[model samples]
Target: MPDIIRLLPDNVSNQIAAGEVVQRPSSVVKELLENAIDANAKQIQLMVKEAGRNLIQVVDNGMGMSATDARMSFERHATSKIANTEDIFHIKTKGFRGEALASIAAVSQVELRTKKEEEEVGTQIIIEGGQLISQEVIHIPTGSSFQIKNLFYNVPARRKFLKSNSVEFRHVLDEFHRVALAHEDIQFQLYNNGEELLRLRSGNLLQRISDIFGRKIKNLLIPISEELEWVKLSGFVGKPESAKKTRGEQFLFVNHRFFKSTYFNKAVQDAFEGLIPQRYLPSFFLYIEIDIERIDVNIHPSKTEIKFEDESSIYALLRTAIKKSLGVYHVAPSLDFEQNQDWVFSIPKKDSPIEEPKIKINPAYNPFKENSKPFTKAEKLNVTEFYSSFRNDDITSDLFDAPSANNEENFLRLMNGRWMIEHKGQLWCIDPYRIHQTILYNKYIKSIKNHALSQQLLFPLERPVYDLEKEKLISIQSKLFAQGFDMQIEDDLLTITAIPSDILQEKVLDIIEELLYQLTEHSEEEFSVFFSKSVSKVSAKKRNEFIQSSQIRPIWEEFKNLEMPYLNPLNKKNYEIISIPNFE
Candidate 1:
């Protein structure tokens, strides 16, 4: 008999933890930036090379660690943030789970240089794969400088899984944005491959937002704040028109810690229900402040998703805050900014109308000709010969059967926006324009779409998304596939050659984008009925209007039955015309 279980090696244990903590380069960025913020640094500088694949360095002017503390900082579970198990529930600082440094060091080559403000000398600690390689007392800056290089170098399998440098770099940028947004009082600077990307100076929250996104967005944002009994909510929400088609601009922070909460997100969305177009989501950067004891951030490996004692209250507060802000801003009501701030002057004179050009029309081409009236049943039957002349039996059969399948086909559009085929007996209808609006709204609300790749583009086009949006993109791969996007990762770039559904591929990209933006906010199910109804109406209208045999002679001549009378008994009520109902 032999023992069945055994302890895993230090390297293996560290690697397993690293898998959870450092899923990508962005994970590393989150850890390092959090550590800097926890250190109470007023200024933090982030620099990345090759989208963080080559190098990721964070230099912060926070309170530096002592010589002894610097060496111990690399040890797993060794943290100054938490004293015991009770401290886990009341975590206030960002880097409480000492595992970040240890996990980070396990998967990459890490070098730490830190010194106290009063001390003349600083300590440098270097580690790789959970093993300390070097520890030296060196003269450097007053805060902390962490450099992580050759990530997953020892684990080729993990390294191979790494997306392109650009993708990885986007992740880093995301982490950088989260911390920067949370702590507006701290100055943050970021450089990528020797190019200055961000220079965020310490100031008000609005200024910090402008620094990160750009000055153009500042004017597009509305201030949102609400102080509830236990929770304090404050942030700026983008005006409905300002939200982008993608999921790049949403930010949520809990007690200065960046985290994701679907409950909270729903609250914000509920608030903007009627104001924002269904196809577009509101852009917001909101921070929630609550008691440390009422929340828990220690559950997840990376500490991104959180659990609250009273999430419903928090959610409601968020929704109300955003809604109130929208009301105050009068976003829907067009504001006369010109009149609001007065200093008007000149009055302009009105001009007369311009002359119209005369257009001569041929009597044959005139739609309003004396004998041109709506087609009657006899006329429709006569025109059947003309319609039949254009195509072969297969095309004719399909066109004839199309009316029967209209309900099912339209229902499919309502259910999933694009298409889905089901039995016609199960569907209903609504206003088509409203269906379009609803579908667009639903898609926009769930900005991340999973579309399948149809075909690659002939030429590879390169574009950029904020580094923070990488995770969101990765999360939305399946939806993108459903939407018909064939995408691949090459560094920070997302190469798209194909779309998910064949229908979207046929349409122009701009139209597709419009559909996406519009349908994202509404309920696909609700819009389905409307969509079906509209499609059915239009299709029915087209079916009733029959043309003469002479007009369609070239196409319909082959299938024409000139001798047969084309009488439709149920043209308006039903598509098919039955000769006689058999009553038994």
Candidate 2:
């Protein structure tokens, strides 16, 4: 047998390398933006078309490259930032390996135009599929411009794996935010398909954050600053009021480079332990400055993961620093102000009659009574009968057969939105909230998938949305429409002419805002589920209130109607039965 192993050709090797360096259009965006920053550009404009499937251009006004350097940029392993192995440990620039350009050029059509400030003319280099097409003198400005076109054109499989335009554009926006956020002194502007999405002016970190997010973020942030022997940290963490159900707003950077560390994130989350809800995450943008030698950034091809020398110490310090900052300011904002207190001692009209409410006392009921039983067995049959109704459905609930419901008006309702039922000497606890949420979720999904039912409002409702959430809302407009949300965007106002029949118009804005937050962290599919869940949650609360005042007859009927009543949209148990011990 002949020796099968052979060295891969340059073009093949570069294409293979591109697989890791340029996984998606957003990956290309990250590389180009970092390169512009490494060039010491004061003003960088990122221009994209068709969500980066067609074009991705980065124009910068910085120190330009020479003609020789322009030609050498597309060569594999060719770099200007690194000299030897020792230099790798003490690196400062973003693009040092030089594989970015070479791998990027191998998979797409690239055009580079650059000229030094002192040079009278510029050089233009074009490469297609790793082949240099042209290198000629051209008249241009005193900076660099890189235009990447037809990303992954040669590789059909990669292109086939690309997500929707909305998703791709969203990812691009994420990269843009990460880069623009870490460097506050550099100006960055983003243009998506001819429309200017973001215009970030150079300023302090706080102002930069407000520019990227909305002006309202200023009120929600708590400033954090600390300096130690090995590490110095400074950033703003979101107040508890600013915490959201989604966890996408957190950002951590080192040496003006954005990276991700789960350990560090836990440090921040731990700091906000009692301030925010358990599932909710407070937004934070933390910057840490340390000696470059103490960390490693080359672990991943994207260069977003860093391996630190004393990670445990850094984690403890970060937690303590954030906790200290949180203590300095109040977590919950006080919205109440001084007002009239006349209502506290109101005097009714002289002729008006006031009736004292009557309270019924159970004469025989006593906590000390040994004969006090859990809920009666009749309520057991009510629940057993409810589950038995599902026996006709294909998915059997594996519950025991029970008799028909005898009056459910006497069932006991616990204070915490739970219903007590007795079955076979076992006390069965039922959660009406989870049941209603799940039923509404299934109904909404069915409506959205089949044909949605919408109610046209008498007048269009206008809701104020910030610039940060506008893109997300717009991206899923079609999906929202399918779910019966007919919306139009003009500036920051989102006008809704119709809403789903299941949703209350009064809570539409809140639900939409929650949906926007969900979209920030979840994909379109996941966001749709979250959207349904949120709407169901709102509807479920109202439903629970209605059931609270009325008898349990309606609840029994609703439970009996569901094909699968056990699945909860909130990932909680609908009901649980605990056995009661018999004591003589």
Top candidate when judged by TM-score against the true structure:
2
Residue-level lDDT of model 2, residues 287-353, one tens digit each, is 9999999999888889998999999999998988887777556453322222334337668899999
- In Å, residue 457's CA in model 1 sits off its true spot by 24
Per-model CA lDDT versus the true structure: 0.67, 0.82
Write one digit per residue (lDDT tens) for candidate 1, span 248-338: 6889988888888777878877877876656466789998888888888878887888889988777778876676667667764333422
Number of backbone-clashing residue pairs for each candidate, in the order shown: 68, 0
- C-alpha positional error of residue 172 in candidate 2 after TM-score superposition, expressed in Å: 0.6
Weakest 10 consecutive residues of candidate 2 by summed lDDT: 332-341
Q: Model 2: residues >4 Å from true position, as ranges?
A: 332-431, 442-468, 478-501, 505-510, 517-533, 542-553, 564-584
Which segments of model 1 are wrong by more than 4 Å? Answer: 332-584
